[model samples]
Target chain A: NAGVTQTPKFHILKIGQSMTLQCTQDMNHNYMYWYRQDPGMGLKLIYYSVGAGITDKGEVPNGYNVSRSTTEDFPLRLELAAPSQTSVYFCASSYGGASTDTQYFGPGTRLTVL
Target chain B: EDQVTQSPEALRLQEGESSSLNCSYTVSGLRGLFWYRQDPGKGPEFLFTLYSAGEEKEKERLKATLTKKESFLHITAPKPEDSATYLCAVQSPGGGSYIPTFGRGTSLIVHP
Candidate 1:
């Protein structure tokens, strides 16, 4: 089903630079999420979408933005990147919005901001 | 605030050894508890979900047990391939969002 896929498996950005982390799921999931994982830390939600056109902030949404224009695509935008943004990012999707729904995750993107 | 804490940040076991990883959580009301396994340089893979206290779920070589305050992941007869970071998370009914709060995770290494 292709499950969930993320683009740019690795990247390095300079301070003040911007980039978009792309996420797509072929499972037709109605729920999509963006999370960041620092070394030795648990995943922290950056943003999430219930469906296309409905997005919400999560635990750590600063310096990030998200747009879900289609059920299959959810992209996270980092504007004016900072060194603190250096972390591994993951994209996940689920069939429903309930907490019990199993989440399928993509191979993470390792980002380094200098 | 919902919080999850996994104990024994890391563990090393010889192949065929058995052990358990602990996850303790604090939340206003628990909606679900989840277990995921993550290999190095890869994303997390869902293992199991427990919706209520006293609930139990099992997969090959892994059994997850949930209580009112904590969850335990028991790995039976572990193999070297079972080496990975095991994560725990809790979900609370938060105004319908129900975002999960995750623990740092327990890293396990089984040597052949």
Candidate 2:
């Protein structure tokens, strides 16, 4: 049922450029998260939203911003993209905030900054 | 700081071979441990969840067990399609937060 979908399957940006990665979910989940995966490193949380209009910083939030304007969308923004920001980005969603709640993830968005 | 570590960064197995991947964690207050499978260029897919020590969960050829300090994902008679990265994550005791600390996944390659 198209659980989660991310746009721009791949992108290449020059240094100092700005871009936004789009993520949408059809499950009407209340919790959404943005994470980045680097080589040999685990997924690092970038930002999260508990619900529409509610957002919070996560473990790694530098050089990025997020907005949750609706129940079905959470977009991650990259301002002044840098080489360090080049990585595979993932968007995930869950029905609740409980520890037992399972998170469903999208395919992924690969971004490269030169 | 809450941390999660996985052993054997990469593993190569033949068809029908069985092996186990380890995930060790250190957190102030444990809530739940999660296992996920991720294929190359794709996001992680949920596999199992273990809430307490001595708890076990099984799905297909994968069996996940939890202890006080570590968790193991045992694959029995795995096939070529089982090749993927296995990730381990833990939810903290903090209320109203679903944030999970994740470990570098164990990349598994099963040859047919």
Give fnat of each prediction, in order: 0.69, 0.76
lDDT of 1 by residue, A14-43 (tens): 999999999999999898999999988889
TM-score of 2: 0.96
User: Over 4 Å off in model 1, which ranges?
Assistant: none
DockQ of each: 0.75, 0.77
Give the chain B TM-score for each candidate: 0.97, 0.95
lDDT of 1 at B46: 96
Chain A TM-score for candidate 2 is 0.98
Which of the numbered candidates is closest to the native, going by highest DockQ? 2
Off by over 4 Å in 2: none
lDDT of 2 at A88: 98
| lDDT per residue as tens, model 1, B1-112 | 8989998899999999999999999998887899999999999999999999888999999999999999999999999999999999888876687777889999999999
Error of 1 at B65 (Å): 0.4
* Chain A TM-score of each candidate structure, as shown: 0.97, 0.98
